[model samples]
Target chain A: MELNKDQATMSENNKPQDPDPRFACEGCSVLLDVNDGDRLVFARLSGGAILKIGNKNYSLKPMIGAPFGSLFQVESGDEGSFLSRILPVKQENKSNNVIDDSRDNRELVDNNEAQNLTGEEIEAMRREGAKGDEIIEALIANSKTFEKKFQLSQEKYLLKKQKKYAPKVLLRRPFARSICEAYFKKYPERIGFLRVDALSLLLTMANVTAYSDVLVVDMVGGLVTGAVAERLGGTGYVCNTYKGNSPSSVEMVRMFNFSDKVIKRIVQSSINELSSAKTVSPEENNQQERVCNAEININEPSTSDIVEETSVTAEAMVVDIVAPESKIIKAPKAGAKASKEAIEMWQENGFSSLIMAAQDQDPWSLAKDVLPLLSCSAPFAIYHQYLQPLATCMHNLQQGKMAINLQITEPWLREYQVLPSRTHPHMQMSSFGGYVLSGIRISTT
Target chain B: MLPTESKKAVSFKRYIEDGDLVIVYERHDVMKPVVVSEGDVLQNRFGVYKHSDWIGKPLGTKVFSNKGKFVYLLAPTPELWTLVLSHRTQILYIADISFVVMYLEVVPGCIVLESGTGSGSLSTSFARAVAPTGHVYSFDFHEQRAASAREDFEKTGISNLVTVEVRDIQGQGFPEKLSGLADSVFLDLPQPWLAVPSAAKMLKEDGVLCSFSPCIEQVQRTCEVLRSDFIEIRTFEVLLRTYEVKEVKVDTGNMIGESHDDYNGGLRPCKRKHRSKEDGAVSLDSSSNATSVVMARPCSEARGHTGYLTFARLQCLS
Candidate 1:
């Protein structure tokens, strides 16, 4: 029995270790990324009013859906864009005369033909299709002090009239980027000032690609998670480690019709599950402890064997912890096994990358809990709606033992409309795109 | 160090492999691609790093040199590759590349075409995202750049996913036989308007197209051509703002302060101490009420505007 045990140990020592697998891509389509037909569309008015045409909700899918913000009337069978125009509410028109606004104190024009005209006459002229510009011209001819006001006031008056007459343009495909802009226009508070420029920056900084194993905390609803999943296409895994158990408020993530495979790959585990996963059982720890104690051999054939032995021992402990952990984590049965294996592979290797974005969760705690899980050289990034919490996290991480090259950044997003004759950046844009703290994990020892 | 290159290969390994093009990450902004060969030796200030020693290790592995100095061995993901590649020419970075990929909707099994493969920076990403079943045809007028890009693909192990050809798409207009077969076409060439007509013709029904330009004049001209055959035209500029965040502990007794939102949880215990010496006029209450605050400032080195991505889809007929 003693001879047999010795032989087993010798052969086990001789066994060659395998290289871990890299991320792979398998055609994750874009339709699943945004146009899954479950998209949440908010109109550009009143805290993003839901745009519902009959029983059907429109999304940017199939590229042929009804445009957003176009005033649609339920016609006999079809909705026509050109046939509909929103009119000024009667209440507003009534209030316009009741309130003797100071703007009307200017001297009246002596054009008696216009002063003789009453409200009914103006209403008749409007109903009869008097061009807004022509009506404004007629009114201008009647007023004697039209040019007396300051430039800003005059511009404001023209803008009010323009808004009253202008038609709402139809927004097609209401994709994520457009949705962000729309939401920003309406309830900027709903999305936390997350702009398309900011979203793209997060995705880019995270190194999101097809077939990568990504871990994220998407507080901007599913914006961050969904965008990363879209980039992963279909082959890799993106595990969302959070602090709670219930469904996330990130409604946009559900809008994407991710495949069962993709959904399975997305493990919505609580932060406790991750924190517990980080803990190796004492028995397994003892086994690794024994493995570590054997590392003093000077006659080892090569450095490869020495490294391989310790890596394998560490890998075994990871497998022991990850198996039960994944059950609650609920990783995909197959592709997710790779994810667990990846975690096991990185047991001694370190983390591939880390991405953190949360509003309620403290950035410092989130980074601290997840930092040690990363490999020594893995890249990590933290996203916060405000910079204060992120700064605290950065400060805390700086004093730690595992991270290096820490820095926070805020991207300045500017847009320009390129046209034949008129080309310039939009006059107004949001000043805040949120802040990101990105750095690489390192081990000093 | 282990003989990482000469070891038994993992099953469908996702980690770094021997002979694979890996990026040696020295720092966040500093990296270089090195083909890890068995038995090869790399010299650095830290010490000698043996390529063979990295063989069986996973990607993102941190290894030590002879003097115990360390460096990260990372798989050359397209993004990392873009950062580490020799700057043969002006390159399309992650911001622009991601914008084009997404807006163009270049899925796997979808056929993608591009002109003037500048640094093969964008092609690497395309090849990986649309690998196994999809095809990426890249054309460059510069013969040497094309040849060099071809070699890069071969080295990166994505030659099968991408095809490199020497053709001035603006001058020759993508191969005639390829007309109406492309799912999407991306143009990075100057005078892209000269090729938009042909690109329009090459796209499949409802196929999307994107053009990257640095000037508004070029986009204006291109938009004119695109209007003839495309719809839903849009131009976007992706700006990246990065911030450096840190927490500071200050003496509230003598300091005027601004309060931001409070962080929900603490990563570490805050070392709070009540101010022993308090002035009656200034101290409204005990100084223990406040905690150290965190703040973030934009990194001075945050990259400014890279370029513009113009996207349009082919006009669809019911």
Candidate 2:
């Protein structure tokens, strides 16, 4: 983990040298001379020939596997430190100049003069007629020196090898799909509509829940929403509306009317059951708060009293329902009357329910009209709007002492694919941008 | 002083020389002339080729062009035969082919295996590498690509060391076919991961294996499949860009002159005229009268981005 001064210096010096000479031999200072058919006993590194000795030069051959420093012995002298001698030295025969005739017709020379032979020498003799004890004796004489050098070479080789082939591992954070899958598996019911902006909030919420599933209605872009849903094994439905191009007030009323019809078909029966429950006294604020501990409203309601108020009205006519600092001018308009009658009819049938208003629409007026018809019914209302208005409405509703709690779910921009060719031809490119809101009602029993 | 623009006038000139056209003919089985005359046109189901058009042009150029339609004129480059060579299987892309040639560490006289030869694209590259002394034993399961590949080799005049054979590598490994005698082996197949074991048998000790796969899943599978047989597996990708050339001027003064022209020309000239009238003399040359064309440089956009590449070295037990 740490480097010493000398080791660091050596490491710095080991940077790659230019014009790398190939096949450098460890055995000899003189490059092997192979062209003269001298039958070199030791193997030379291929292409290792860099210097010439006497009158001959040798090219390094691949056969010599030793490092450059091992083959040649360096001896310091008065002149300089030069290669004194090559290992497994050969003493050339100076006496045998003439051929001799014998039964084998081979010239005989003294073999005793041959010094310690190298691996290269042994291989060369094998190629020639020299065999048996002669080769064995040459190897035996050189074994000690060879072993010493080989061990040193091997230690250095292994250190270099480790530096080259060390195992490397890198870690990265998992993608969105992986995160969603991990959280959704824990609390499956909490996952709601899939949209990009909603998913971003959901991801943040997952962190808050310690990766527990919590309810989410994503109003983000379609593709990202779909991908998130797929990761969670849930369904995603895109709401078709451009948030920037909102409908007129008249159109808004029609949409609210349609929503009322939808609520009748979906939650009317449940509303009746909750309305028929034995009415508790309005003095149970503290006890009710204890029951809905985890259901703390994100916004302050306008109502001052935190107790339930009951009033049953006989007429299906319009009435002004007043709250603290706010008034419901058209209390029982056509759509409002229908919604109120639907809630009352459900209360007559006995069902528990919750009503969630669509984005950009008022939920208080509907709540006020319906509450008068079913005062014994505990109705929960939820709506989404810009932060300031929503917070103000919540404060007024809380001050007025209405039996309603407001939770602020942030508005999210949803992306939809628009046909560039058909709309906005000047900007002939498809892009996504639009905001929508969604809120959930939690029934307090 | 700035050097004057150098201009040289070129004159259109043509020269004609007399030469003899030697034509060699070979007898076909049906008695048709195999080698057509210099003036004769060779006709096939696809198109017609004028023998005369090819006589004067160098190799690799399209021999015939009628109307505006023309096929690529090609010189007899190694790549031409490599492209047109017959194959019993899928061919390697040019990107993978170039990479393998560099990775195998091949040199002249190396004995190479064009194994599992799908389409013979890699085989032709191998043949070109080992040419003059080296040889390529291309093996394939399909007979059609092999026969056509052999014909292509003959046409390219590179019959040396390129032996095409029909052999199924999966049923019986290439070791029996090659007899453990090749220096290098290149495997390009759908299941090269499966063929690695067989390639091990054919490759020499310290030999390399270059596998080409398009998908990451295939690469991962191949790596897992090759783990026991090879080591030092590395992945790489290459991108190629061809640039268009255009002349550009680096002078900033030209831009400054254009911007300041109206103010300097109108105001400075009028002021100078008033001063000249006061001095009772008129001058012709003025800074406001100067005008020059600022030439814009032409340039071409670079083309092409070749896909990813992965490589692994074979580690043999000594």
Per-residue CA lDDT of candidate 1, range B104-201, in tens?
76655578999988889989877755644678999999999999999988877778788999998988899988888898899998899999989988
lDDT by residue (tens digit), candidate 2, B40-156: 665543366565654544211223444423332222223333434444555664444544564564434567876566666667666645544568887777888778778766654
Candidate 2, residue A230: how far the Cα is off, in Å: 57
TM-score of chain A of 2: 0.20
Worst 10 residues of 1 chain B by lDDT: B271-280
Please report how far candidate 2 places residue B309 from its true position, in Å. Answer: 4.3
Least accurate stretch of 10 residues (summed lDDT) in model 2 chain B?
A: B1-10
lDDT by residue for model 2 over A1-445, one digit each (tens)?
1212432343344433321112222221122222111111122112332223222222232223322222332222344222222323232323321233112313323465333655677657645544333554455455433233333343344443222221111111122322222223322222323222333332221111111111112222112222222222211111111111111111111111111222222111111222333454555544434433422321122121111101101011111122223221111111111244543333343112222323443445434333332212122223332334333444334334333212333322211111111111122221211111111111122
DockQ of 1: 0.20
lDDT of 1 at B246: 36
- Among the numbered candidates, top lDDT falls to 1
